[model samples]
Target: MTPAQTTRRHVLVAIALVWALVCGGLGWATRSAIQLDSFEAREDQRRTDEVRMERALARMEAEIAPVLYPERARPYMHFRSYYIATEARYRSDSSDASRDILVASPLKDYRGPDWILLHFQVSETEGWSSPQLSSEARFALPAGGIPAPVRPREAAPENWFAALQERYTAPMLEQVLMETLIHSGEVEGLSAAGPRPDAAPDAESGVRTAAAESARRAERLLQMQREIHPASTCEPELVAMENLEAGSGQVLYNRETGACVQVYAPLMTPVWLDLTQDGEPMLALVRSASVETSKNCTLQGVLIDWPKLARELTEQVRDIFPEVRLKPLLPSEMAASATVRGRLHTIPAKLVAARSPPVETWGLSSGLIGGLAVAWGATLLALVAITYGATKYLTLAERRMQFVAAVTHELRTPLTSFQLYSDLLAEMPQESAEKRRHYAGILRAEAARLARLVENVLSYSRVEETAPNLRLAPTDPSNILEAAAAATAEPCQKAGKELVIENHCPRETRIETDSQFVVQILTNLVENACKYSADASDRRIWLSAAPGPGGSITFEVDDAGFGVAPKDRRAIFEPFRRGTSEQGRRAGGVGLGLSLSRYWAQSLGGVLQLKRSSRNGAHYSCFSLTLPSAPRQC
Candidate 1:
């Protein structure tokens, strides 16, 4: 290899290495940048989730205000008085007259939520009174003749209250109100599941706590109720509710003051004093007057049914946050205000959520990722193509340099022989005919060798530079074969090989081409066949013309010398790339005969191919040249 060619190859190798590094670095950087973008998106999404959660919680706080306070419905629980009449004739004495007399306050028509188990009013004047029961308090007739409120039979046998009394079941709420106003007992058994059984310090305590704590719950109401309730997130010392549902309704007002019933009755139960003291987690609102009126010890409140209230509240906030909870705060929990959101001012409950912080993604998509991968691969492919093309062209340049050197040496040998023969003929005596004739014959052989070499050199140069000058005409395939035979006849005779032509084409078959170009192309092929097959034992060359593939005429030359090696099949068609076979390597004219012939074939708008070789058979190389039958411009 030449120094310049070796240097060019090294440069190409360095360029390939550089391209590989550059492409690899670009791919790595792209991947890292995408991962960073995704991380930033995740942080952005978490911030967004926090803001949305705050707005939803604020709405829940506003909506729940009325239900918790409900101070507007306070008037419905107030008490009033009425009168009763006694008939003299119906009395045991059987008297004649009937008279009206003042009596105790009657029970009002109490219509309120069942969750509000009981309502009571405490005062110094008449002690405790409720609209659910009639009062027996007596007063002297007023100076303004105000009507009296006779006690009603609210605890009549048919009423639920009477059944409780008949069964001797102690009231859950009334006893608590009369004894311990607000204490730990109320908070004892409120569970998200159900009220736990209280250890009976005794039987009386059990009966009182059972009605308040062990009430049944409707859990199959909604799946939301099943999902998030007060119990799941913020469990309290008192209650833990799941799916803390809520409901809303218009308050019913029925103030039948001064109303009466068939009889006056109130529950007078066996007094059992509650011994437990007031504990840390009790909720109450007690108000007193500074200017003190006749009703002094005023304490009015309702003992709420917690299970029913939990359902109402959890349902209310499900839209705002599906996983919300309503949990009662312990005294310690209430004091620590830093961790609390949506804590109720009206009650000891607060709201909590049972979900995690979220991530956001905007710039990262599957399409973006896929596009980057494809682009990276495409760039690498383009680099490989450019590198391969550079290497191929470099190798071609090296082969061209070798061919030039080889041709210079070959031309010198023939020119020196021709000069030597001419000198010998001139120096011989006129009488010695045999010696003179022998020298003359040597001169002719040298002239022919020089001429063929010169012709090939000139023809190759002209063909490479531009299209050949043509004289276009109609010619028969047989006529082209005959002319090629005539041109290569001397070479075959000198090599002791017979040139044979097999013409299968019809007489009428014609080719519209430059006949001169076709003859030169065939002359090159026949000469090349004779030169390479010189060493073969069979000194015969076959030149055949036949109809070829794609409606073109084929002129093939078959030889039985050392055929082209499999490795040289493709390289032999390229300029200066000769076959490596022993016979081919020894006999060659700059490797341009077959190359120039193939060029001529293509310039005539046809194909030239090595259709058969020793690789496909026992031992023959067949070079096939096919020309177009159709007319074409010169």
Candidate 2:
């Protein structure tokens, strides 16, 4: 095959390869996009699961703890000494499998903000009792936002003591004690003011008697003019003071004295609290399993502030309960079953703190999905990058074609003129002096034109190929302008246009740049201006150089001609582009001159733009070039 055919096949193969690669890359990218989409769905599901769980937790908390505590049942418990007894039972019946009596745990060691001691009394023969050892307890709860109820009027001592005598004094005086000699040694001493048992006096017995009498006397003094004592004939009323509710350990107070002696405690003890099981359980003896008790008269005669105590307890509960589980409903069937089987006990304070779902958890799903999408997007971007680089290779091939075509035409035009003129001068003899001189001038003009064209094409090719690589040299400002003026004089004179040098810059103001490139720029611009003004009799070309800001020099070439239209200014500077060419006017060149000049200017870190124009004979197309100033000599 011929060299031309080989070159064409190579170009065709290269173009086909570029298209094939781009197509394959794009297909791969598309597949990746689909895979990412599928993964995104799974990510969305994961986020949805998380959100559902959070919402369910919020619902559970809302159901369990409402915004406000009920208005009617608020009460505070006051204990002199409170105790909680816990006994593990292998079987349900306490009697079927009995164990030794053990020490009870004190519910709270000392007085806390919620409670205070009121009165206490102990028994000589027994551990403690409320009646024979008369005691009173006080508590405060919300009563229409008031502290407590008004204190009742004190009852007569005789009436209160008489009632206490019938309750306790009758129970202790047993049949054996009334008919036989039931001494203190056999029956122990009775409660003070009840039956006083007669027994022999010994060192140990004397100390016990003195201690019991001291406590009894103290109780009697405090209740001298109060309501019925602990062992009053109104014994039923006394038992009522110890009543308790089933769950929350809240108290009930006496309306008359604003005294709380009864409270609620957990009344059921399970071997294991079944979390999966819903609703209350069915079982016997559960009621008596969690019996609440008061320790000594320490529990009686106590005062409490319910609201303040509730606040403090809330803080304590928050501190103690730190972990929260996802609500069971939010998980998938398998996941939820697993969570339910897992160890779930206490919930975090935040779950129960508010009545609605927290706003912070709102975007839980979107955030997770977004993170996954970002990772997938990174992979997709790599595929797109490969496609972009391959496509750019095709564009480069097209620019190469344009370059070859433009360069060939540029060489051919001037070469043809120079060859024709040189042949005429060579054949003419010295005898035909004036004709020979004319031919010599034509030869010189054509040769110079060829030289300038070659220089422009070569310099512009270099500038375009390696942009920002400017070949700079410091020289006189006039050097470039003088060379351009000399080359363009013939064209200007032919067109009857005056080319003027308006030098505002100092003669010594030098610049660093490729002289050939500068001369080419001025030559093309001045030649274009002259040709465009060929119809005008009084045509003028203004070449000016001035000192610009930042120690730079600006060179401008202006021509009085049919100036460019506003819309065509930007479009005219592109390769193979021309302004709106008019009929009956000198045709513009192939339109590479301005485009090449722009490339040259930019390679030197400068710009070329149309400054201004006019409709009159002084119509101007300005070409300004700027470059860095050289350092001054010492």
Model 2: residues >4 Å from true position, as ranges?
Answer: 1-395, 411-444, 464-483, 505-518, 531-538, 550-552, 562-609, 613-620, 631-634
Give the per-residue lDDT digits (tens) of candidate 2, residues 1-634: 9554576577667756765775677667656655666566666755664564455444444432331111011111212133222232445465412123222223234323222211121222232232212333112221222212331122222222222223222113221111111111112233234324767668878976764653443333223212211222111212323321112221122243222233232111111111111221111001010111222111111122222323443444343233332222211132223344221222212223222233332233455457546755764576456556645554455445655765576668677867877787788776988997887777777677677666656655665466544456787778877888897888888878888986787767877677776776778788877766566545788877788998787888776566766677887787655666572123535556888888766656677777675434444366677766752221
The Cα local distance difference test for each model comes to: 0.55, 0.46
Give the distance in Å from residue 265's predicted Cα in candidate 1 to where it truly belongs. 37
For model 1, residues 1-634, the per-residue Cα lDDT tens digits are 9697678979787877879787888879887768777886676665665665676555655664554455323421133232222322536666633233333333355455544444444432234444555543212221112221221112121232222222222123233322221221223323333455656546677765543442221211111122321121211111100001010111111322222211111111111221112211223322211011111123344334444455666777677568877776544344464246666544556767665554434467676678777887888787778778777777777777867877887788878887887787788779989988888788778778778778878888888577867677888888888888888888889888899899998778888888888888777777887888887787878889998766689888887776777788888887777878777778856887778888778778877888565432554478888888874653
The numbered model that scores best in lDDT is: 1
Give the CA lDDT, 0 to 100, for residue 296 in model 1: 15
Per-residue error for 58 in candidate 1, Å, reads 5.2
Q: By TM-score, who's the top model here?
A: 1
